[model samples]
Target: MALMITDECINCDVCEPECPNGAISQGDEIYQIDPGKCTECVGHFDEPQCQQVCPVDCIPHDPGHQETREQLMEKFIRLTASK
Candidate 1:
């Protein structure tokens, strides 16, 4: 599943650089995650890098963009192939 940054985000700027998919970006107030680009670090790491670095633990699964583990891996492959 994809992850999202909650309103609890302090904008500390740590999570943005940790996203392997470049899905995190500075929003109008807090950071935002692009569900289409997020793969929960499936092919890159065992855990989500952004979640690992977020100080406030504000990152959580995006229910609206839910996908299975295999789907996430497919997304990872597609993203890297395009690069």
Candidate 2:
């Protein structure tokens, strides 16, 4: 599943740099995670890098954007291929 930044985010600026896919960005309020670009680090790491680095622990799996491991891997491949 793609990960999302919760309201509890402190805008610490740590998670943005941790996202390998560049999915995290500054939003009007806190930070935002683009589900389309988020693979939860499936192809890059065992755990979501952003979640690992976030100081506030605001990142969590997005139930609305759920996907299996295979699907996340497919997304990773697709993203990498385009770049």
Candidate 3:
């Protein structure tokens, strides 16, 4: 599943650069995760980098963008291929 930045985010600016897929970005009020780009760091790491680095523990799985590991891997492959 894709992760989402909740309102609890502190905007400390730590998680953005840590995302290998570049799925995170500054939103109007807080950091936001692009569901289309997020793959839970499946191809880059065993854990979600954003969730690991967020000091406030604000990033959480997005129920709206639920995906399995296989789907995430496929998305990762597609993303890398376009690059």
Instruction: List the lowest-lDDT window of 10 residues for candidate 3.
Output: 48-57
Sorted on lDDT, highest at the top, how do the candidates line up? 3, 1, 2
- Whose lDDT is higher: candidate 2's or candidate 3's? 3
Best by TM-score: 3
In angstroms, give how far residue 6 of model 2 lies from its true place. 0.7
Candidate 1 residue-wise lDDT, 1-83, digit = tens: 89999999999999988888999999999999999899999999999999898888999999899899999999999999988
RMSD of each: 0.6, 0.6, 0.5
Residue 78 CA displacement from its true place in model 2, Å: 0.3
User: Deviation in angstroms for 22 in model 3?
Assistant: 0.7
Computed on alpha carbons, the lDDT of every model, listed in order, comes to: 0.94, 0.93, 0.95
Error of 2 at 48 (Å): 0.4
The full ranking of all candidates by TM-score, starting with the best, is 3, 1, 2
Question: What's model 1's TM-score?
Answer: 0.97
Candidate 3 structure quality by residue, lDDT tens digits, 1-83: 89999999999999999999999999999999999999999999999988888898999899999999999999999999988
